[model samples]
Target: MNVIEMKTPKFLVGIETRTQNSLEIKGEGKIPALWNQFFNFFKIDKKISSDIYAIYSNYESDENGQYDYFIGYEIANPDKYLNGDSYVVKQIEVGTYSVISPINKISENVAYSTWQKIWRMNAKQLGGERLFHTDFEVYTNDKKNGQQSLVNIYLSLKK
Candidate 1:
C-alpha cells in the first residue's frame, strides 16, 4: 500500500445520490445505474474533470446501524446543469487528506482488505484524527490493456 498526504481544493459543485444503509450502498448494484442516470441527464454538459469521487459524509449509524454515502463527480459550473429532485448538487469543503492506494487489482476483496487495514490503523498511527466528514475514493479511469484499474481512497485528517 502507498500512503501520502495531499491538499485538496474544495469542490464547488457536483451531482449526487445519497444512500442511508449499507444494503442500498452505491456499488451494491446502484452505482452503475446512478452513473447512467447522471450521464444521461448531463449528456450535453462537459465534465470539469475526469476525477470521479465517492464521498462518505456521515458514518454515524442510524437506528439500523447504517451510514450515509454520496457518489458523484465534480463539475466546473453548477448553473449549467439542470437539477431534479433525485439529483442534488453538493459542495465539498477543502482539506488535507491521507490518500491510500492499496497495491491490488480493483475488486471487492481488495476493497474489503484496504478498508480493514484503514480501520485497524488508529489516529496515532495515521498521524491525525479522522475528520469522518468527507472521506472519499478517487477513481482513476486510465487503465492499460490487460491491467486492472486502481482507486485512491482519501481519508480526511485533522492534526
Candidate 2:
C-alpha cells in the first residue's frame, strides 16, 4: 500500500448508477449490469485495454449506504462525451488517498474480502480518517495471455 496526494482534480467520462454494499450482498447489485452497459458503450475489453477507472462518489453515508458508482476513462475533455445520454461526467476533487493493490489475481470473492478489511479498519489502521468523498478502483489491463482481473483500490483519506 502507498499513500499519495492528488494535487489537482481529475475528470472521468463514463456511465454511473447508484448502489450499496448491503444491497449487492443480497443479490441486488446494479453494478454488474452497469459494467455490461459500460462494455457495450466503450466496446473495449481486456483484449484491447483494461485501463479503466471506477469512481465511488456522492456517498449518502458510510460504506453501507448508497453511493454513485462510475466506470470510465480519465480524460482532459468532457465535452466530447456530453452528446450521449447514457454517459455521465464526473470530477474528482483533490485529496489524499491510500493505494492498495490487494491481489494480483483478482476474483469477486477476494476483491470483496479486501474491502471487508477496509470497512473494518479505523483511522489508526488506515493511517488517517477516511474522507468518504471519492474512493475509486483502478482496473489495469496488464494481465497477458488470460483475462485475470486486477484490484487496485484507492481509498480517500484526510489531509
Candidate 3:
C-alpha cells in the first residue's frame, strides 16, 4: 500500500446507489445492477480519462454501514450534466489515500477477490487507520480490446 495526497477535488459523472457491505457479500447487491446501468444506460458527455472509477463515498458510518456507490468516468463537463435525472455528479474531496494495487488484473470477479484480501488484512497491513469516506478503485487504461489489466484500490485514510 502506498499513501498519496490528492491536492484537488476530482469530479465523476455517472450512476449511484446506496448499499451495505452485507448486501454485497450475499451477492444481492445493487452495485452489479448499477454497473449494468453504467455500461448500458450511462451517456458519456465529455471525455477526460479512460480510467473507470468505482467510487465509494458518503458513509453512514463505515464499511459496515450503508454508503453511496458510484461507477463513472472523470468528466470535463459537470455543469452540463447536472440535470439530476438518472445522472449525478460526485466530487471527491482532497485527502490522503492508501493505494493498494492488486496483483490480479481487471474483471468484476478479481475486484471482489481483492476486497476479500483487503478485508482479511490487519491494522498493520493497512499501514494506517481507514477513513472509508471516499475509497475508490481505478481501472487504468492498460488493456487490449476494451479490457483493463489492472485495478488500483484507493482507500481514504485518517490523517
For model 1, the stretches where C-alpha displacement exceeds 4 angstroms are 1-8, 12-44, 61-66, 143-147
Question: Model 3: how far is 51 from its true place, Å?
Answer: 1.2
TM per candidate comes to 0.68, 0.86, 0.90
For candidate 3, write residues 1-159 as lDDT tens digits. Answer: 888899988888978999999999899999989988888887775659888899999999977899999998997668877877878788888998888887765665888888888888766687778887899988876757456468889888889
Whose lDDT is greatest here?
3
- Compared with the true structure, model 3 gives a TM-score of 0.90
Per-residue accuracy of model 2 over 76-148 as CA lDDT, tens digit each: 7667667778678788788888887775776667667888888887787776888889999877665492766
| Backbone clashes in model 1 | 0
Q: Which ten residues in a row have the lowest lDDT in candidate 2?
A: 41-50
User: What tens-digit string does per-residue lDDT give for candidate 1 at 1-159?
Assistant: 334455445453344555553554435645456667656764434667666677777666431344445556777666654555545565566665777777856775565577668878877766677777677776666557364567888787775
Name model 2 segments beyond 4 Å from true.
43-50, 143-148
